[model samples]
Target chain A: MSTATTHTSAVVHPEYDRLALNRFGLWLFFFSESLIFLILLLTRFYLFGTSRPEELNQTLGLAITVILLLSSFTAYRAETAIAHDDRPQFLRNLLATILLGTLFLLGVVLVEWPEAPRLGIVPQEGFGIAFFSMTGMHAFHVLSGVLLLLMVYLNGRRGAYSSDSYWGVEASIKYWHFVDVVWVFFYPALYLL
Target chain B: MEAKKAAKLRLGWIVIGILAVLTAVEFWVAIAINSALLYLAVLALAKAALIVQYFMHVNQLWHKEGHE
Candidate 1:
């Protein structure tokens, strides 16, 4: 009598599936958040049409936009570094991103907010209502994003993530990028248009 | 693996360069052109696509779990 053997190799990595699911859930959250921003965007045009205030600080607006964009770049690098197991690069980039984010908030809150009223953009007027609401909502997101990055940075210092697993880092960076995307639309809507 | 990481790093710089140029052009258009809504909207969409695709890796959402 002869016997035959059939062998199958199945190496199950549950974390991979778990990570994918986690990412999908995060994206859904972003989609819902997007609806809020979209409604605010539509309100801007609905109330004020294409006309923007000449008093709007175009220079400061552009400066903060640049700062926010730079932060996104650093955040991207930080995520990529963690994915590649470059812990030092990841931490450094994370810090850079955090600094840029803080700068952006300062620009909006200290410079832009005070300058807006001086430039004649009050909370009561049509343009003022849209401008404050739009920028205010966005600034809140940036503040939360900065806090999340701080958490990730502290976790990184303790070696919480590696090439095989870094969901926390990924999730935080994705949120940061979403904030930048909002500003991408908001900058032009509030300043340029 | 190293090569792939290097490629990703390079891609990030290139995307940033394009974004900077687009932002400059956006400023110029806003100043030089009176009716710039259409142009600005297109530029904004393009910028968002770059961030979503390259920076955020939205394609990874569709890729198999291990692949991303």
Candidate 2:
């Protein structure tokens, strides 16, 4: 009995190790991706010097900020619901997050860009290039996040998560919120300053 | 247990409300007030912190043991 207990205590369930390992790996990936955004910010400041285009629609920027933040809240709700074993609420909130995220991408790519041309806006040296590059990169992240959220939502609808094993929901929501956090910085940087 | 979760969910709404108000303030400061770039940067960092903490579950970075 003593030897058996020792053996049992020496090892943990693989699920625990797997979850911890996954979290570590995901965060490592985030850290590396942060470098790319950092370069974008550096490039923006290097090029613009504290000045941005006044014609760059602050109103629409604010609107995009609001929608993306709303999606973060929805993502939070989805994770929380799954933590409590509420599958239906989890599914609904995840879908809401995906929808808001998609709208944010559209607001940037379709609405913001095409509208820029009509505003008599021109790249004007490196200004427009840097601005588009920064926002475009962020838009890419948003698009990827929306796709991931859809996968999570679909898996969740099939009852893949539970109160005890909801790491899938947690990881996806973390990614969603990370994307929102990036926009919190990017919105002000691109549109405000 | 259920009640605790319900309470947490309520807190989620409150966090988003704070985020909304902060973004509005960012809009005002950006154009109307014309605050310094440093101030805007600070506001952006605050917003990021709120999302990462409450929404991203950064606090749970080491909580996977209990989760699993």
Candidate 3:
């Protein structure tokens, strides 16, 4: 009897199965979010054609892209650290991600917005509306992502996760990467192409 | 197990390096090959796959017999 139960249990990992369900739900959320971004992207092409405002800063656009990409890397590092039960490394990387993400947002809200004329964002036209709306939505996602990371970091600080169970970390990271992926498209649409 | 985990961590850095190089290429294409929208689109898809397949762990999504 004991052997039978042990054999059955050995072939099954219910915790992981549950985690997979959560992952599924998150992916569904991402799919829906993609629809929203798709419309924004389409609007970019429809409104601006192949040309962007001549005033846009290619350098700042690239800088923000690099920052967001580096933040994605740090988020990956944090996830990997937590997977190995390295709480300190996880915390450090999480902080770095938050800082980098916030910097990206500030670059948009503070510097980028103020330099609208130079960036070719005319508030009175379709160009301004589409450009700001696109970046603003992405910035909002980044803000939510930063909040999510902070929540995960707080829980992680209390030793809420371990090598065997770190679904919170996993969930946060997938979403963060999605935000980065969105920017990968948005950067070119708004600044360069 | 430990060795495999270490390799996985190193893979993260490898993926990041690839992404950086691709981004540089994107910038070059944007400035130099201004008419190459299709090329940019393809590069964007490739960059997306790298992140999704690796960082997002999409490969871990399915399993047949094993519950884990």
Candidate achieving the largest DockQ: 2
**After superposition, which runs of candidate 1 have C-alpha atoms over 4 Å from their true positions?**
A1-11
In model 1, residue pairs whose N, Cα or C atoms come closer than 3 Å (at least 3 residues apart or on different chains), thus clashing, are none
All candidates' TM-scores?
A: 0.94, 0.92, 0.91
Pairs with steric clashes in candidate 2: none
- Positional deviation of residue A15's Cα in model 2 after best superposition, in angstroms: 1.6
Candidate 3 docking classification: acceptable
Q: Write the per-residue lDDT of candidate 3 for residues B1-68, one digit (tens) a residue.
A: 56766887899999999999999998899889868678778888889999998898876667422111
Write candidate 2's Cα lDDT for A1-193 as tens digits. Answer: 9999877865756676777788888888888988999898888888778888778887798888889888888889888888888888888889999999999999988999888767765556557888778888889988888988898888988888898888777877888888888888788778887
* CA deviation > 4 Å runs, candidate 3: A1-12, A118-120, B64-68
**Top-scoring candidate (lDDT):** 1
lDDT of 1 by residue, B5-63 (tens): 89998999999999999999999999999999999999999999999999988988898
Residue B5, candidate 3: Cα error in Å is 2.7
> TM-score of model 1 relative to the true fold?
0.94
Better candidate number, 2 or 3, judged by lDDT: 3
Between 2 and 3, whose DockQ is larger? 2
Compose the digit string of candidate 2's lDDT tens values, residues B1-68: 78988898999989989888888888778766655698889888888888877777666676654462
DockQ of each: 0.65, 0.73, 0.49
